[model samples]
Target: MAFQQGLSGLNSSSKALDVISNNVANASTVGFKNSGTVFADAYASSLTGAVSKIQIGIGSAVQAVRQAFTQGNVTTTSNPLDMAINGNGFFEIELQNGGYALSRNGQFDINKEGYIVTSLGDRLMGYQAIDPVSGDVYAPATASVDTFRPLIVPASGVGAIETSEISLNLNLSADAEVIPTPAPPAAAIDPSDPLTYTYSTGIPIFDSLGKEHTLSFYFVRRSDVVDTTTAPPTYSEWDAYTVVDNDTSTLTHNSTIGFDGVGRVAAVTPHVTAGVTPPTNGSVFSALLGTDAVNPNVSTLGLNAITQFGGESKPRELKQDGAPPGEISGLSISRNGIIQARYSNGDTKDVGIVNLTTVRNNNGLSPIGNNYWVETPESGGFARGTPGNGMNGVISAGQVEESNVDLTQELVQMIIQQRNYQANAQSIRTQDQILQTLVNLR
Candidate 1:
C-alpha cells in the first residue's frame, strides 16, 4: 500500500512538471493560454459495513488540466494587419477545409489573391463589402452572417466616378485694367496668349473612363458700356471663357459676370450652345461627354461663389464631385472592427467588419494548436457579433497579444514539483528499507 501511494505521488508530480514545462515553453508564443494541473485524492472503501473515519488515502491522480483565459499583454507592431483584442472575444477564421476555427491571434496579411489570410492560409471571415444583388456597399444595417465572406482588396482599382458637380469660390481683382472690345468680328481668343484673358485657373476633371482633362477658366475684365453719369457706377462686368485641354475650338466665350460696386456678384450670363446650356445664374457650366456614351448629358460645373474684390485674383475654394480610379494604398481596422481601405485618390471605403465569436464556456473549448480553439459540446454554441459590442472586446490594430504564461510563476511551480517528486521517491525508499529490515530479522 505504501508503494502504491508513493508511485501515485510520483505520477502526479510528473504530471505537474509536464504542465509547468509546457507553460514555460509557450511563454513567448503569441496568444498562448497557460494550463495548470489539478489533483484529486484516490480513496477506497473498507470491507466492513460501517465506514471508518480514519481510512487512509491510497494515492493522488490528476483531476483536470485547467486553462487560464486571462487577458494577455498587447505588443504593438509595425504591420497594419496585425490585431489584438482588448477584452473578451475571438477572431472567427475559416479553415481551408471549410471548417471554422476561433483564435485570438491576429497576425494576418493579404494573400496573392487579395484575400486577407493568416500565416497558415486560413481565411478571415467578415461581412463582404458589396452586395451581389443590390450592388450596394455593406453598412451596419446590412451586416450579418449571410453577408459574411472573405475580404479581398480590389486589385485593379476602385472604379471611377464622372465629374458631376463642381463648386468654385474665387475673388477677382476689381482694380485691374479693363480690356477694350475687339473688332465687331472679334478673332477667337487664344488661351496660350496671356493678353487674351486677364486671369486663368485650371482644374483637373475626370471623364466617364476615368480620364483626366484640365478645365480652364479665363476671366477678362470688360469696359463698362452702360451710362455712368446718371447711375452711381453700380457694377463692373467681366467676360469669362471656358476651355478644355488646350483645345481652343471647344472654347466658349459668351459667359459674363457682373459685380456690384461693393464687390458682390449681382448678375451672370452663361454660354448657350446646341449641346451646352449653362445654369440661369451663369454659375453652372455643363461639360458634354461624347454622344455615344451611356449618359450623354452634360456634367454641371458650379462657380456661384465668385467675388470681385480689390485684392489679387485667387481661388478660395475649388471642389469637384468626381474621382479617378484609385489603387488601394493602405488599410485600417477601427475599434468597432470595421476595416477600411484607403485609396491613392484620397477615397476610403469600408471593406468589411471583423466578426468576433464569444463562447459561453471558454474553458471548455478544445485547443487545436496554432493558438486556435475548436468548439466542443462542452463549450456550447458561439454567439457571433462585431467587436466592442456587449461583452466582446474592441479590436486594437497593429498590435498582437502575447502569451499569458508567466515564466517566473512556472519556474517556482517547477521547483515545487521537483521537491514533491523527491519526497515521494524518499517515501518509497524508506518503505523498501523497512522491508529489508524485516528480511534481516527473518
Candidate 2:
C-alpha cells in the first residue's frame, strides 16, 4: 500500500517537472504562453460508499494542465509588419486546409503571391480592400466572422488616378503693366516667348492612361488700376490662359480674376469651353478620352489663393491630386489594425483591415504549435472584430510580444518538483526495507 502511494507521488511530481521544463524552454519564444500542472489527491472508498475519518490517502494523481494567457512583454523589432496587441484579442489565421486558427505571433511577411503570411505559408486572415477607391465595406465596425478573408497586398501598386484638381497659390505682381491686346496677329500669347505673358508656371498632370502631360498657366494683366476715386485705386483685372502639353485644343476655357484696391481677391471664374457649363467652385474631374467639361471635368484649376500684392510674382504653393503610376514603397499598420501600403507617387491607401477573434473560454483552446491555438468544445464560439472594436485590442506596429513564461519562477518550480520526486522514491525504498525485515521473521 505504501509502495502504491509513493509510486503515485513520483508520477505526479514527474509530470509537474515536465511542464516546468517546457515553460523554461519556451521562455524566449515569441507570443508563447506558459502552462501550469495541477495535481489531485487520491483516496480509497469504503464498501459502504462512505469515506472513514481515519482512512489514509493513496497519494496524488495528475489532474489538469492550464495555460496562462496573461499579457506578455512587448519587444520592439525592426520589421514594419510586426504587430503586438496592447490589450485583448488574437490574430486570426487561415490554415492550409481552409480551416481557421488564432495566433499572437505578429512576425509576418509578404509571400510571392502578395499574401500576408507566416513563415509556414499560412495566410493571415483579414477584411481585404477590394476596391481601391472605397476600402473595406463591412456593415459593422468590425468584420463578421464569415466576412473575413486572407489579406493580400497589391504588389504592382494601385492604379493611377488621372489628375483631376490642381491647387495653385501665388501672388501676381500689382505693378505690372497691362499687355495690349494682340493686334493684327502679333504672336498671340506664345508660351515660349516670355514677352507674351506676365507670369507663367507649369505642372505635370496625368491622363486616362497614366500618361504625363504638362499643363501651363499664363497670367496676362488685362487692365491697369481702375476706379481711381478711392485711395490706391479701387480695382485691377487679369486673364488666365491654359495650355495642356503646348496644345491649345486640349482645353478651351479662358478665365479672369479681379482684385480689389487692398490686393485682395474679389471673384474668380473657372475655365470652360464653348457650350459647356462650368462648376460652382474649384473641383477637377477627369476629361479622359472624349470627355468634356460638362461631362468629365478632368481637372479643376484652383486660384483661390491668388492675390495681386505689389511684389514680384512668385509661387507660394503648387500641388496636384493626380499621380502617374506608383510602386509599393513601404507598409504600415494602424492602432485599429488597418494595414496600408505607400506608393512612390505619394499615395497612401488601406490594403487590408486585420481581424481579431475572442472566445468565451480562452483557456479551453487547443494549442497546435507555432503560437497558434485551435478552437475546442470548451472554447465556445468566436466573437470577431477589429482592434479597439468590441472586446478586441488595439495593435502596435513594429513590435512583438515576448513569451509570458517567467524563467526564474520556472527554475524554482523545477527544483521543488525534483525534491518531491526524490522524497517519494525514498518512501518506496523504506517500505521495501520494512517488508524485508518482516520476511526475516526475527
Candidate 3:
C-alpha cells in the first residue's frame, strides 16, 4: 500500500511537471493558452459499507486539465492581413476536410487563388458581401453548428462606370468685345479657326466600354444685344457649338445662349442635327451621344449661377461621374471586421466581414493541434456575432495575439513539481528499507 501511494504521488508530480514544461515551452507562441493539471485522491471502500469516519485513501490520480482562456497581449505586425481580437471571441476557420475549427490566431494571408487562409492552408470563414444579383447583403438568422463560409477576394479589376452626368460652373469675361461683324453661319464656323469662337474648353468623357473621348465646347459672342444701357452691355444671343473630335457633320451648331441685363445667363437652347453617324467606340468625340442619337445636355450654362463677370474666364467647378477599370491597390479592415478592397481608380468594395464566435463554455473547447480548438459536447454551441457586437471583441488589423502563458509563473511551478517528485521518491526508498529490515529480522 505504501509503494502504491508513493508511485501515484510520483506520477502526479511528473504530470504536473509536464504541464508546467508545456506552458513554458509555448510562452512565445501566438494565441497559445496555458493549462493546469488537477489531482483527485483515490479511496477504498469496504465490502459491506463505507464508514463515515476512518475512510482509507489509496492513491492520487489526475482529475482534469483545465485550459485558461484569458486574453493575450496583442502585438502589432507589418502584415496588413494579420488580425487580433481584443476581447472574447475566436475566428472561425474552415478545415480542408470540410470541418470547422476555431482559433484566436490571426496570422493570415491571401492565397494564390485570392482566398484568405492561415499558414496551414485552412481557409478563414466569414460573412459574404453583397450579392451581385440581388444587391443585398446576407444576414444570418441565428448561430448554428454550420454557419460559416470561406472568405475569398475578387481578383479581377473593378469594372468601369459610364458617364451619366456632367456639371460645370464657369465665369465668362464681361469685358470681351462682341464680334465686329455678324459671325459666320453654323456651317461656316470652324473650331480650328480662332475668329470663329471666343472661348473653348475640353472635357474628357467615358463610354460604356470604358473608352475616353474629348467633348469640346466653343462659345461665339453674337452681335445681338439685350441691354445696351448697362455699364457692360449684355448680349441677348451667343452661338454655342458642340463638336466631337473634328467631325463637323456631327456638330451641334448654332445653339442659342442668352444673357439678362445683369450679364447672368437666362436661357440655353441646344440644337441637334439629323442623319449623323454614331461615334466610333474608341474614337475621341467632342459631344456625348444621347439615347436619341443627339448630343446630351453637357452644361448648366443657363443657371443663374453662371455670370459674365469682369475677370479672367475661369471654371470654378468641373466634375464628371465616370471611371476606368482599376486594379487592386490595397486592403483594409474596420473595427467591426468588415474587409474592404481598394482599387487604383479610387474605388473601394466590400469583400467580406469576419465572423466572431463565442461559446458559453470556453474552457470546455477541445484543443486540437496548431493552436486551434474544436467544438465539443461539453462546449456549448457558438454564440455567433460580428466583431464589436454585444460581448464580442473588436478586431485590430495588422496585429496578432501572443500566448497567455506566463514564463515566470511556469518556472516557479516547475521547481515545486520537481521537489514533489523528489519527496515521493524518498518515500518509496524509505518503504523499501523498512521491508528489507523486516525480512532480515525473520
Candidate 4:
C-alpha cells in the first residue's frame, strides 16, 4: 500500500513538473497563456469491512490544467504586418482547405496571390468590402471566398486628382486714372505699349486625359472709352480677363466674372471657348471680399495650392455639395478608430474603420495548431462587432500584444515543483527500504 501511494505521489509530481516546464519554455511566445496543474487525493471505500474511519494512504491524481486569463503588455513595432488586440477579441482566419481558425496573434502577411493572408497562408476573414459606385462586394456573386488583401489605393485615380470643384480670388486695384483705349479692329498689341497692363498667372489644370495643362490666365486691363465730361476719379466696372493655353488660346476674353466699385468682384459670367459654350447657370465664384480684409481664397491662390478644373463637361448648377480636387496631404487615426485622409483641396473624408470580434468561451475553442483555434460546438458562437462597441475594446495602431507568461512566477513555480518531485522520490526510496527490510526479516 505504501509503495502504491509513493508511486502515485511520484506520478503527480512529474505531471506538475511538466506543466511548470511548459510554462517556462513558452515565456517568450506571443499571446501565450500559462497553465497551472491541479491535483486531488483519491480514496477507496468498502462496505462494513472493519470500517472504523481507517485513513487511506496518499493517492494523488491530477485534477485539471487550467489557463490563466491575465492581460499581457503591448509593444510597438514598425511592421504593419504585426497586429495586437487591445481587449477581449481574436482575429478570425480561414484555412485554404475551407476550415476556420481563431487567434489572438494579429501578425499577418500577404500570400503570393496578392491575398492578405496570415504567415501560415490562412486567410483573414472580414465583412466583404463594398464598392462605392456599384454598391456591390466587387467580386462575382458566385464566389464564396470572403478574405481580401489590404487595399492599396492608386496614387492617380479619383484620389490622385479628384476635380470636384474650383475657386479663384483676385483684387483688381482701380486707380481711377485715365488711360488710352485700343483703336477699333486692333487685335495685336505691343508688349511695351503703356496702353496695355498684363495680369498673368499659371494655373495647373487637367486635360481630358487627366494630363496637366498649365492654363496661363492673362488679364489685359483693356482701357474703356471715357467721356470728356467724366473726371480722373471715374473707373469702369468691367475688367477684361483672358484665359490662354499657349498661343493656341482657348479663351481670349473676360471670364464670366464681373467687378463693382472699390475692387469688389460681384459675379462671374460662365466662360465659353471655341465650339463650346459655358454653362449659363453653372459659373463659379469665391466668397465676396472687402478691401479691409484679405480673403483666404486669394491667399491660397497665391500659394498655388488652389486647383482649377478646366474640363468641358456640361456643368451642373454649382454648389458646395461635392468634394474638391484634393492632394494627399496626410492621414490620421480617429478617436473612433476610423482613418481620416486630408487633401490639399481643403477636404477630409473617412477612409476605413477598424473592426473587432469576441468569443463566449476562448478556451473551449479547438486548437488546430499554428497558434490558431477553431470554433467548435463546445465553444459558443462568435460575437462580431466594431471595436469599443459593447465588450470589445478600442484599437491602438502600431502596437502589439505580448505573451502573458510571467517569467519570474514561472521560475518560482519551477523551484517548488522541483522540490516536490524530490520529496516524492525520497518517499519512494523510503518505501523501497521498508519493503527490503520486511523481505530481509522474512
Candidate 5:
C-alpha cells in the first residue's frame, strides 16, 4: 500500500510539473495566461475495507488546471497592425459558421473585399442592432471589430461649403506703400495719409465642378484716418477694398466704407466690379482680408493711421459670403474616442467613434486557433460599449499592448518544478527499494 501511495504521489507531482512547463513555454505568447494545477489528496474509505491498526495516508491526485488573466503591459510599436487591450475586455470575433468568437490578439489585416479581417482571413464581427424607434437598423448600425485597417480617403461628399470659423495672424506695417490707389481717387484721398498699407491673401478655391482655382485677395488702403468731426468731410470716407480674382474672370469688391462721428471708418459694404460678376463657378470659395481691419465691422483709427477721404469712388470690400476650396489635410483622435478629419478649406467635421468590449468570465473562454478564443456558455456574454465606457479601457492611438510574460518569473517556476520532479522520482525509488526489501525478507 505504501508503494502504491508513493507511486500515486509521483504521478501527481509529474502532472503538476507538466502544467508548470506549459506555463513557462507559452510565457511569450500574446494574450496567453499562465495556468496552475491543483492537487487533491487520495484516501480509502474505512467502511469499504477491514479495520487496520493504522490508516496510512494516500498520495495526491491532479485536480484542476486554471488560467490567470491578469493585465499585461502595453507597449508601442511602429506598425499600427499591432494592438493590445488596455483594460477589462477582449475583442469579439465571428467564426466562419456565424458563431461568435473572442480574442485579445489585435493583430489584423485587410481582406481582398475591403473588409477589415483578422490575419486568419476571418471577417471581423460588428454590432448591427435594430433601432427601437424606427423598428429597423439605425443609421450606421454596423461597427468594425478589427482596428488595423488603413483609413480610407473619400473622393467627395455632400453638403455646401461654409466659412464658419476663420483665424488670422498677419502684419500691417505703417511703412506699407500703396499701389497708387485705383483711379479717380475712389473718394478724394486723405491728405494726412502718412503712408499707405498693402496686403494680400491667397486662397486655393475649388469650382462647383471640383475644378481647382486660386483666389488672390489684394488690399490697398486709401487712408486710415476718417474725420467725421469735419461735419460730413469734403472727402468720401477713407476706405479699404478687397479685390477677388483668379487667372480667369476678374471680380472686384469696391464697397465704400461708412464713417461715424469721429471720422473713423465704421461699417464697410463690398460690391463686385461693375462689369464683372461674382464667380458662380466655384462653391462657397475663399475670402481673404489683407487690410489692417481685424474685425469686419470695426476699423482702427488712432493706433493705425488713415486719411479722411470724401468722393464718388469708394474702396470695395470683399463679401463675407464668398466660396472657397476644401482639402482634407489631417486627422485627430479625441480622448472620448471620437475621430475627426480636418479640411484645407478651414472646416472640421466628426467622423466616427471607437468601440470596445469586455467579458464577465475571461478565464472561462475557450482558446481557439490563431491566438483567438471563443466565448462559451461558462463565460458570460460580452459587455459591449464604446471605449472608456464602464470597466472598459481608455482608447489610445498609435500604441499597442505587449505580451505579459515575465522571463524572471518563468525561470523561477522552472527551477521549482524541476526540483519537484526530482523529489517525486526519489519518492518512487525509495518506495521501490522498500518493496524489494520486503520481497528479500520473504
Candidate 6:
C-alpha cells in the first residue's frame, strides 16, 4: 500500500526541516558551521535478484547530517583577545573533563589565575615561553611540540638589567690649547676650571641596583707634535680622563688618543688601560683605575672611534645595554600566533605560541556544544601545527569569524521541506479513500 511510502516521506522531510531550522537560528553565531541532511532511498528485495527495473522504492531514510567546514567571513572587533582564522585549522583548548577539544572560536581572556581562558572556563593550550622541564621562566629555551601547556601571563614584572658595557663616539677640537701638567704642591685637573680640560660631557649609566648615575669624560690636550715630514705641520695628541659625578678625585686616565697628525684624522688607535698594557703603536696610560666606582668596567673603554678635527667638540652617539623593571601594560598577537606582553618600561617579549590542529576529515568531528568539536576515529589522526604554518591558517588578531550558515538558503530549504510534508499527507489521504471504496463494494 502507499501508506508506508507516504509515512516514510513524512518522517524524512520532518528531520530535514529540523536541520534547516537549526541553521537559520544560528546565522549570527560566531564560528558556527552549517549542516545539511542527506536522505537515501529504502527498498525491499529478495536475495534471488529481483528485476532491477521492476523494483520500486519503499521509502527514504536519513543518511547523514554533515557540517560544512568552509572558511567564514572575517570581521574586525574592538577586543584584542578576539582572533579569526583566514584559511584552515582550529585552536586547541582543554576542558575540565580531563580531555581536550578543538575549536574555531577565538574569544579569550585572562582569568585571575593568569591563564588564558574562554567564556566556558576552558583554558587555551599553547607552547610556553620556556621549556616545561626547566621550570625557570626567566631562562629562554626551545619550545617542544610534544608537550602543551596553558598560556599564562607572568604575575611579576620583568626584572631590571644592570649596565655592563658602554660605547661612545665623540669628536674633539684639534685647535684646543694643551693643558700644562702640574708639578709638586699643585692639584690635578679640577673639573670647574676651564684650563683643566678642553671638552667634557657626561653619559648616563645604571648601577647594580638599577639606580641612574653619570660617567663624565674629560678631554685635555696633553701635547701637540709637529710632523715635519708632512707638507705642513699637523697637531695631534690628547689625554682622555674619566670622572664619576664630577668628582675629580675619582679620575681614571682612560686613554691617549692621537691622530695621523697630517691635517686630517687619517688613523686612530685606542690603547685601553689596565695594570699592564698590550702591545700597540702608541704609548699606553698606566694609571690605577681599581677604585670602588670604576673597578667593575674601567678597562672596557675604547676610544678607537674618537677623532681630532677643527670643529666643535660634542658626543655623536651614546649606547648602553640596560633596562629598568617593567609592569605588564598590554598584550599583542601576531599573524603567526606569537603572543607578546608589553611592559610599562617599554619592553616586550613573547609569552606564548598558539597551537593549531587539523584532522583529515572535518565532517567526522562530533560537536559537543559551545562551538567546540572533539576528534573521533572517523576523523583520523590529528596533525598539530602553529598558525600560518604548513597547511594551517593565519590568525587575525582583534577580529572574529562570522558564522558560515547562509540564512537565505536555509529559508528556501525550509519551504521545500514544508511542501514535501504536505504532499505526503495528501498521499495518505488518497490511500484511505481507496480502502473506503473497496469496503463499499464488498
Candidate 2's residue-wise lDDT over 54-172, tens digit each? 88888999889999999999999999988998888999899998789999888899899878898889998887635447543222334665557888877566666776668888999
- Candidate 3 clashes: the total is 3
User: Which whole-number lDDT from 0 to 100 does residue 327 have in model 3?
Assistant: 89
> On residues 257-322, what C-alpha lDDT tens digit does candidate 3 reach at each position?
667667676665545423332221111223455444334423222223456767776778766676
RMSD values, in order shown: 4.3, 4.2, 6.8, 10.1, 9.3, 5.0
Best by lDDT: 1
Question: What does the lDDT come to for candidate 6?
Answer: 0.76
Q: Write down the TM-score for model 6.
A: 0.78
List candidate 4 segments past 4 Å from native.
1-6, 47-60, 130-162, 169-199, 218-244, 252-355
- Score every model by TM-score: 0.82, 0.84, 0.72, 0.66, 0.67, 0.78
Q: Which of candidates 2 and 6 is the stronger one according to TM-score?
A: 2
Point to the candidate with the largest TM-score. Answer: 2
Query: Sorted by lDDT, highest first, which candidate order results?
Result: 1, 2, 6, 3, 4, 5
Clashing pairs in 3: 243-286, 244-286, 245-286
TM-score of 1: 0.82
Query: Which of the two, 1 or 5, has more TM-score?
Result: 1
Question: Ten residues in a row with the worst lDDT in model 2?
Answer: 285-294
lDDT (tens digit, per residue) of candidate 1 on 1-442: 8888998999999999999999999999888999989899987678875567988788999999999999999999999999999999899899998789899898999999888899999999877767568554543455676777776665655778888676668998987888766886875466877887788897887778777778888889986534344333537888888777778777877577877677766667666443665554555555555554445435555656889888799999888877888988998999998888888987788877888889999988999989889999999998888888899999999999999998899999999999999999999999999999999999
Q: Write the per-residue lDDT of candidate 5 for residues 1-442, one digit (tens) a residue.
A: 6666767777876787777777667766666766777788877659867756777667778887777777776666564434566777666666667676667666655466544456776654433333356432211333455332222323333233333222222333333333456466363232224243244455443333333344454445454344546544422332343323443233444344444444343454445333333222111112433334221221111112222233322223323222445555655545444545566756665544444557788777887656677777888776766667678776555455555667687678768767766776787788888889999999
Clashes of 6: 0
User: Ten consecutive residues with minimal summed lDDT in candidate 3?
Assistant: 276-285
How good is model 4 by TM-score?
Answer: 0.66
